[model samples]
Target chain A: MSEAFSGPVAGHVPVLRLGDVLMVTLQGDLHDSTAQQLQQDLAETITHSGATGVIIDISGVEIVDSFLGRVLAEIAAQASLLAARTVVVGMRPAVAITLVELGLTLPGLRTALSTEVAMDLLTQGAPRVGVRRESP
Target chain B: MPEHTAEETHGSPTHEVRDFLRRRREQIAQRWADEPLFRSVFTVSRDEAVEAGKAVVDALAEVADAGRVDDPDAAGFSGVREQLARMGVARGRAGLTAAQVSSELATLRQPVENLLLSDIGEAPAEHVRACATTLTVLMGTLRVVVMQTALSEGEALIDRQRLQLLEVATPVIKLWDGIVAVPLIGTLDSARSQVVMETLLQSIVEQQARFAILDITGVPTVDTLVAQHLMKTVAAARLMGAECIVSGIRPAIAQTIVHLGLDLGTVITRAGLADALKYALHQLGADIVGPTANGTGHR
Candidate 1:
């Protein structure tokens, strides 16, 4: 799982393509420019590769300011436009808390516990009701 | 001659008051032992009251010697301020208000004044008046210190109990695998809602639960602030990769939410904790079917 993303590094953040799905793992030191470039590269890859899903693993990120939160939300928005479902996986509890505190709930963004669950949600043609999304 | 030179160095009535207190410590303490402040606090024994009285007298003398007779927060009064505050609290517990305790402290100056005036023939009359005035000023400062510390002590105690209440009220329970619930009881204030959100998020990570349920059936009301807080908590859970379900929105609360024009868009809601747990189990692919004929079934 640690070496899941081996092929095709895009900018500082590695964007790996596995089968029909694209994997992008974000690190803790993801700067403003690095995230922007990853967004651009991810959008291009999704279109070119015709990937059905984009799974972004953000477990390593400890601090997420409003800028990163907005960028993540935008990335998901872009992925959906490219006809690929984006599932943000492995968001740390602290990062979630900071994003919420900053009033950035990233509305309409899908989240999964891990890359395995993300793959399950994307690959399995189960009823979308199982993956419930609610805003309180 | 050395003592005279030392007294002259101060060049004020503070030194005279300090010496007078030290010289007449025993008599002053003996008199103050009967005052309400000392008498109420040292109820077990008269000797104990006298001993406590002597300590206060010594602190006052030190303050006067340091030329800070008018400053209640002088380093010399540090040891006795907390003790006096506690004594004031005891007086409060005994049904005497702070004003009464201060008046009791005011009565303390008379005995010291008598001791000072008794030797007025030896010292000049003007000098005796100066020492008496200094004593009044010192006692006034003591009153302010007593009021300040006692009020703060009461506030700190209330703050602590409130924190403990919050901890006891919010309990995050693990309902099943990949599911956690916080059964919140009582009204949801802004401060309390903050605690609920933090506790739920932490429990989700620790249990690695994919589903989080917030059961607010025990909550009495749903005002705008509380509804807003609930909204924030739900959003936070989603960001952390856990699906949060808010359950137990009673009929009245549901109506109130709509009337207040509050929007809980995209967040899941259920009728009660049972329903919330059922939804979570279903999402986890668990069926709640009855047994066929063995008279056995999993709930």
Candidate 2:
């Protein structure tokens, strides 16, 4: 079971694996259905593997609307609940604007320039967990 | 000039008949002073009163030539005198003295210089009142028409402006697998942000998608208020069971986040869409790799 969790399957979505860090690469568009499947698979992986962190790669996606952006944030929250850190990598410039406009920021999810950078950050040490101040 | 008695009236030429109709119209217009509705809205100004007085004197000349009155000479003279009196009153209201009013009226009655000057006195206020009522009606109608036109054009302009703003602010795209993407490209002012939020929420519920990604890579900067709105979207997504990922953070934006002292410590941050995707897959355990790696680069 652990070996099967090492990398993405041939027919399934592509995910990158580097030692303790797992990276999933999303290609094409991410709407509600795709986001749901991604969330379910990620949650199971965190629960089963006891892996410390997960990284999502979105370099191939051209456009991202509000719905897809929300999914990414949800994954982070879910991963945190399962005692795993979530990181997203390679977001496009246009995608960034849409997310900000939609106000879709993940509270604690670590974002990186690339999968390699994300993996590097995860493996180096305990991820710096910044505490959010409660809004009065 | 084979003018005859009453029997000849029936054989009048077309031109004569037309002339008769024109004279009848003039009479009706002259009698308009007695009509209440017409009088209510029209108030004749001093200039209009003087012009009308001149026109009445001119018409009397024509009527006198046709011998329509029993005593044409006396009637014509009396008509001129009456007009002069009316002119006097109009001039008085315009701040003219009795002598000035008389001089002005005399100049207007130049064509009828032979008219009797008897009974020529300052015109009664009622004459001015009648002229004023007629003028008021004309001005009021004109004002109503102008206002209606302006209001209609203003509404059209507002609608056009609204459409232009929406076109500039929103970008919609449909991808494969029943997924639709609506990219918001601009600074999310509070108002614009609300529109984006409402649109996405409606689309997700309507489309019933399993995954939704909100990539804000085009965003130049994110302040605390923007960050808070993002948090709200994430919460909203959860309620629908649709996954939401935030992607794209320029170094500048990240710096702003830190500088603004926003503790997005609990919020998921993605450098770009790729990273968000990788993390998303890992969560689903769709990672073919053994459970050794959690699929997210963050440890």
Tens digit of lDDT per residue, candidate 1, span A1-35? Answer: 13444323524687899988999888766667778
Q: For model 1, what is the error of residue A125's alpha carbon versus the real structure, in angstroms, after optimal superposition? A: 4.5
Which structure among the candidates has the greatest TM-score? Answer: 1
Error of 2 at B210 (Å): 3.0
Clashes of 1: 5
Q: Best by lDDT, which number?
A: 1
DockQ of 1: 0.36
Task: Write the residue-wise lDDT of candidate 2 on B127-183 in tens digits.
Answer: 333323332332233223223333444466689997779657765444322233555
Native-referenced Cα lDDT, model 2:
0.53
Interface RMSD of 2: 13.6
B30-121: candidate 1 lDDT, tens digit per residue: 99998877887998999988888888889999999899988878988888887888887888888888788788878888888888778554
Candidate 1 accuracy as lDDT: 0.84
Instruction: Give candidate 1 regions above 4 Å deviation.
Output: A1-11, A47-49, A125-136, B1-11, B296-299
